[model samples]
Target: MVSRLGFLGVIARLFMWAFLLGLAVVVLYPLLWMVLNGFKTNAELFGNPFALPTGIDFGNYRDAWNRGVSGYLATSVLVTVTSTVATVFISAWAAYGLTRVDIPFNKVLTAVILGGLMLTPTVALVPLVRMFQSIGLYNSFWALLILYTAFRVPFTTFLIRAYMIDLPREVDEAAQIDGAGRWTAFWRIILPMCKPIITSTVLLHVLFAWNEYLFAMVFTNGSDVQTLPVGLTSLMSKHGTDFPVVFAGMVIAAVPVVFLFLFGQRYIVKGLADGVGK
Candidate 1:
């Protein structure tokens, strides 16, 4: 019976490893193929889709950069950075208030905020467009910034609030006993302690703002304000035959967020676990 149990454990381990290997291939192969294709010429790509490039070349990447990708990348960076800062800080403060402060109708306010998660972005699209246009914000940088920040705040607040709720009230009492005000306590102590979750929310918001398409497309017309998602579409349309350059543009767009997630994945896991677990 002991020998049989050991054999079953070995089988289970092998099965798990095989499953993981398959999953890795499924996730990584397309990315690898994309990068490899970025180095090939159009003829070479059409000639043999799966074959390796004849030689390493940077022309495709250069051409992609010169053909308005640089502008799009800059716009994406601006929108993503500004919106992320707005969303995370606002959410953090809202979370701090909801969890630590004794305000009137606290539960009602919490419900009203978290309830935003149920409000579909598509449902409000028409109204948002009309409002922005009336305010002369349509096809502008601030339009994307305001939209992304507003849409993301509720979810970000929910994540932070969940984590904040698990923290002991004694921390606040301690700060007060030492003659610290609420702002000082939050700025010095609570915010520092909430770093793990804050990192997670920041990463999440970056991903959203970077990859957002519908608003980016609808709100921005000129190449000056268009983001990667919209710019990539325009690239494909304008250079339909130059698939290599298109692939190169995609690789450029994906690299930052991919590297970011790889570096911060541990924080994301820890934050979500601690925030949601309690």
Candidate 2:
């Protein structure tokens, strides 16, 4: 009887594994299809969507690389990189100050910052556009950069501060006794210690900025300044029925985000577990 129960348990577990594996394939099949179709001619693609390409046609990649999408990708990289760095730095400093400093109404200020997370950016687009226009940053890269950094800061700060609040207070005290100022301790000790959470936050913000379409479209007008998501829309409108080129652009657009998510997943999990009580 004991041997029979054990064998049945193993079978059940295997069934569970197979179910989950099937589910994963189900979820990922569309992405796989998109990528594979990019390498096939239109007829070959539509005729047999699931079949492998007869011959690997690299034209899609070449066309995408030599055209508008490549430059758009460069713009995306620039914006996402700069905005992620700015958001992380400013958020780290703000979180460190909020956690370490003994200032009046600090709690209130932290609450205020946290409240920004509650407000959706879409709701504030008109006023924000006007504000940026007045400040001479509208329709430019700086506009997108500033908007990305500002909108991302609240959650990033909240994440960092959650982790910061849990750190050992003794480190800060010891540094102070050694004549280290708040900035010195934060820069030298606390910042270094929060590398995992910082990395997670930066990666998250980069993905967000890279994928965001509503703000990018509203704020950026020039082709030279447009990022991948916005540029892809223009490409689609101008290249109707050119599915291969569109798919090619889509693949190029997905590269950074896919790579980041796959590689930074561990840190992302760690940060969420530590910061948001996950």
Candidate 3:
């Protein structure tokens, strides 16, 4: 019986490994193909889309950069960084207030904020456009910044608040006893304690702001302020026949977010585990 049990365990282990290997291929193969295609010539790509390139070529990448990818990349980076900072910090403060403060109608406020999660961006598009236009913010960098931050705050607050709720109240009491004000304690104590969730939310916001196409497309008309997602579309249209350059542009756009996820995946897992597990 022991030997039979051991044999079944081995079978289950083998099955798990096989499943993982298949999943990896499913995820990684397309990305690998895309990167490889970026190096191939247009003719080679059409001739054998599945095959590897015959020679390395940086020209396609250079052409992509020179065309307009550099500008798009810069815009994406600026918007992503600034908006991530704004979203995370604002959400953190809001989370602290909702979870730790003694304000009236706190529950109603929490409900109202979290209700934003149910609000669809598409449903509000026309109204938002008119509002931004009326405020003279349409087609501007600040427009994207405000929109990204505003849209992201609620979900970010939810995550941080969940994590904060699980924290011991003693931490706040200890800080208060030490002559620390609420703002000081939050900035120095609770905020630092919530680092894992903060990192996760920052990465999540970065991904959202980096790849956001609808708002970027609708809000910005010029290449100078358009982000990677919108700019990639423009690149494809302008270089419709230059498929390799388009592939290179895609690779360029994907690399940063990929590296970011790879680096912060641990924090993401931990933060969500701690936050949502509550």
Candidate 4:
């Protein structure tokens, strides 16, 4: 009976490996195809989409970069980085307050913050556009930054608050007993202890603010404040026939996000698991 059970376990393991192998191939092939096709000319690409490029072509990348990708990249970096910082900072503080404080109407405030999660961006687009324009923020980098930060704060606050709520209350009490003020304890102790959740929140904000399209499209004009997604669309439209250059531009735009995920993936998984599971 034991031998039969072992045999079944081995078969299950093999089947699992095969399934994962196929899944990996399915996920990776499109990315590999895009990168490889980026090296092929229009003739080469249309002639044989599946075939490897005859030679590596740096010219496509160079041309793609020259054609305003550089500017778009800079703008995306600025908006993503700034917005992520602002979102995480503001959200972290709010989370700390709601979880740790005994303020009057704290429950009402918590409900209000969580209520933001129900809002879909499209519902508020017209009003947001009008408000930003009235405030002279339309078609500017600040428009995207403010919009991204505002939209992201509520969810981020919730995540951090979850993790914070699960944290040991003894730590905060001990800090207070030792003469540490709330601000000092938050900055010096609580924030450090909340590193895992903070990392998760930062990565989430980065991914959202980096790849977001609708706000990037609506909030900024294409000239100076356009982000990578909108920029990529414009690139495609302008060089509609230049598949190689467009592919190169896409690969460039994707590289940063891929690298970020690879580096922080461990922290992201751990933080989210701890924050959500407990």
Please write out the lDDT profile of model 1 over residues 1-278, one tens digit for every residue: 99999999999999999999999999999999999999999899999999999999999999999998999999999999999999999999999999999999999999999999999889999999999999999999999999999999999999999999999999999999999998999999999999989999999999899999999988888888999999987767643569999999999999999999899899899999989777
Q: Over 4 Å off in model 3, which ranges?
A: none
TM-scores for the candidates: 0.97, 0.93, 0.96, 0.96
Model 3 lDDT tens row, 1-278 = 99999999999999999999999999999999999999999899999999999999899999999999999999999999999999999999999999999999999999999999999899989999999999999999999999999999999999999999999999999998899999999999999999889989998999899999999989899988999999987766643578899899999999999999999899999989988886
Clashing pairs in 1: none
Question: In candidate 4, what are the lDDT values of residues 1-278, reduced to their tens digit?
Answer: 99999999999999999999999999889999999999999999999999999998699999889998999999999999999989998998999999998999999999999899999999999999999999999999999989999989999999999999988999999999999999999999999999999999999889998899999888887568899889977666643568899899999999999999999999999999999779
**Error at 120, model 2, angstroms:** 0.3
Worst 10 residues of 4 by lDDT: 232-241
Candidate 4 colliding pairs: none
Which is the leading candidate under lDDT? 1
Q: Mark the regions of model 4 whose C-alpha exceeds 4 Å error after superposition.
A: 238-240
- Residues 1-278, model 2: lDDT tens digits: 99999999999999999999999999788888888888988788778878987888889888877779988988999999999999999999999989988888998999999999998998999999899999899889999889899999999999999989989999999998999998899999999999889988987888799899999999989889999999987656544466777788899899778888998899888877877673
Candidates 2 and 4 compared: the better one by TM-score is: 4
Sort the candidates on lDDT, descending order.
1, 3, 4, 2
